[model samples]
Target: MRSRLPRLLTPLVRAALSKRVLPRVAFSGAMSAQILGNRARSITTYTEGSDLPRVRPHVWPAPSKDIMAARDFIRESAASPKNILIVPDREPDGMASGTIVSLVLQLLGKPESEIRIHFTAAGFTIFNPLERARLSRVCQKENVSHVIVLGQGARASWSLLEKSIETKALIINDQHSDRFLENTVAVSASRDPPSTTSSLLTYIVCSELHPEARETTGWLALLGIFGDLGARASLEPPYPQELKDFKKKYTSTHLRDLVTLLNASRRTPECGTRDAWEILQYTPQTNPAPTPKSIMKGEANAELRERLKDAKTRVNAEVRRCSKMPPRFSKDRKVAIIFMDSPYLVHPLVATRWSNYFDPNLTKLVLAANTGYAEGKVSFSCRAVSGRARKGDKGGPKEYETESWDINVISILREYLAKDSLLEEQARGEFTNGYKRATGGSVPLDVWMLFLEKGLEITPRKGDFPQKHALDYIQD
Candidate 1:
């Protein structure tokens, strides 16, 4: 018999049908599933979702109107394009590549002959001369006419594209506030408050594109969104609800696992944009067969999923090692800093994992540094523990102040960077957001350690970032 509860008494009836009465029902499992389904529907149906509480890793809120504006921008941009090249920063980042894949899928209807991709180096790092040469040559060989930059395009890339002179159009679809030109087609949640690049891009493409394109591309955008905003999104109202709806359509765990796998695959020193692109190509499809070598060859191995699992195990082991060691406490005793002697490639990942292991009751902030003596630089990653009690939280948090401030760890590191003359105060955009609470970047290793040992009172040279860091010194 079908189970039916009276509509008027639904709330009271469900409440009364508690654990005591649950097992007594003939269709207990079905009843439980139905209740859960109803609850899920209610979460999306809540009137004017702004009344809903914010959750953490700090989702910056964007208004629904702005989300629609960004959507319209992308839809209009994608409507017409020929010989398109997806230019993302060459850094080994999952979100960066996720954006690339999202766009590729949006343009999937276009002939393969028309779509091409190039990954550019990040802004802070000096581009490899050979890689720059390769990029120029790739653009010419592919006869790229329209370029869609996924992240903030490095100045070096912009200059190279200009020099090539064949590109007639450029589109900036990034999350950052960087506006290369007044006409750059970039819509940023950061630039446009409360919307992340991933959220904006996902909303735009899904709402505008064909159903087939939306089905293929929508999940990749969510992966990118999780990569930037963490599992709990901080996007504006309808977007967050949109994310929840998307998650419900599939196994959320698979999306999370794909994000982890992308990070693990990109963790190695050998990985770059090409590997990221290959990984992106493989991520959207659900094939029972082994990962095809044709999809991802060379650094993009077919066994990457297994390899990522192994990497997580190793990273977890290292976190345990760091936990056993006595951390360097800040003078206030609020921050715990750990310095790792691990290889350059593993530092950020190790630091990120280690940050998750902190005793929140004891430490408010966690900083992890991996130094490269040979490269003469130290890469640092910092985080704020979510469990730490905030100053005003004695009674409890207010509606907006749901999570702790992201701790301004980026600004803290930047102060030392500026004090040492390695970076100017305005150059804070160099670091990538692995998570909202997590930020890290390479500073002059020798100069940073001096400030770490001595106070910022020490003066260093102006513009002395080493052309190559310790990561460059390592041989395969």
Candidate 2:
């Protein structure tokens, strides 16, 4: 009943024992404790786990006011006598959020026919006029009575979306909500660096419908969490109980691999979000639900592996080609612009790749602009230079507030657009869009050129950024 770790154990042996890393028997269990004196006690399975205090099942704090409001809205809407239109962002987190909504609705007895999933066009957030018009039309004919917006756009965009669509009730769930709208809820892992993903927030709200809501869709929730938060979801604390439960069932690496494969469905040139959703959806909503393993191993679907390979292959080639482009910083050394003409949607990928190499203090953001990604539009992706808040830095993302330590690159772009007289007249799609911290814009040729020539105060040399000026912001 008593045990003590021998100080004589080497670090490697200690780590092996602590992590249970020594194969089937576990390092600690493989060795029986030896008693040396009257004070010493012998215990088999000398696990570091045994030395630690027992941890209780994590109980979440009572849902916040916003969470309660979202819960109420979903509860009321579930029994609504009309169609509910679900508009998900066109990426992994969005898809996972939409799927969670669909499953929870069915759990609340809402029929499948009443739930409709709408995918916005690529390179378009809800802020895009084209997508807004599409949503307005979808809400027309008085058929869609309830609306749930998931996994994209900040609260401002969500506010505008609510006014744009004429639904009886609307719920906005996002990771970047500055303030809660009428029916908006925001969540994150910890308040400082990473936010609770949109999909996980949806699961938390849906749990009010039934306790099984969390049990059934915990794995699905991690899809969105990992898709948005990346590996930080597993690393960060204030960890969600649902996420903890999922880790019990699957390895962090395996979940990550699953997220990559599923994300590939949408990121490829073809954009197979629907295909991804089909494989990811938890059918029948029962205890023996399908898991990430089923999708990875291609259970009942051999084509999954092939499709994943095709998507990854195309993305890898494009990323490799565009990642070679070097960054050009602004006069103040705040913004680092890297321009490449790629036909694939690799701007975000290359921007993120470049972010890994940046100095968090010197480079505020890395903007990867792809002129060839969209026809006649210069699509750009923005990434914050990696850094964490120190003491007294979490007040705001502005230079003065955070010492530009954790820059709000989104605000910088938005401020430029708002102050510049040239961009004031530009339409929504022709300028800035996306989230608060992770924002980017699609600029037409004229605007793109003006931005390149005058905005950053950098002259685009043919050697530095070939097509930026040569093609007049168009990539031949």
What would the per-residue lDDT of candidate 1 be over residues 47-83, giving only the tens digit for each residue? 3556654222221333345446544544443444655
Which residue ranges in model 1 land beyond 4 Å of their true spot?
A: 1-82, 89-109, 120-134, 152-183, 190-206, 234-236, 240-242, 272-276, 279-304, 307-326, 330-335, 356-364, 372-376, 388-403, 414-436, 453-476
User: In model 2, which range of ten residues has the least summed lDDT?
Assistant: 32-41
Write candidate 2's Cα lDDT for 337-373 as tens digits: 8888876777888887776565566768888888776
How many residue pairs clash per model?
A: 9, 3
Top-scoring candidate (TM-score): 2
Candidate 2 lDDT score relative to the true structure: 0.63
Each model's RMSD to truth, in Å?
12.0, 12.8
In model 2, the Cα lDDT at residue 138 comes to 79
TM-score for each predicted model, relative to the true structure: 0.60, 0.73
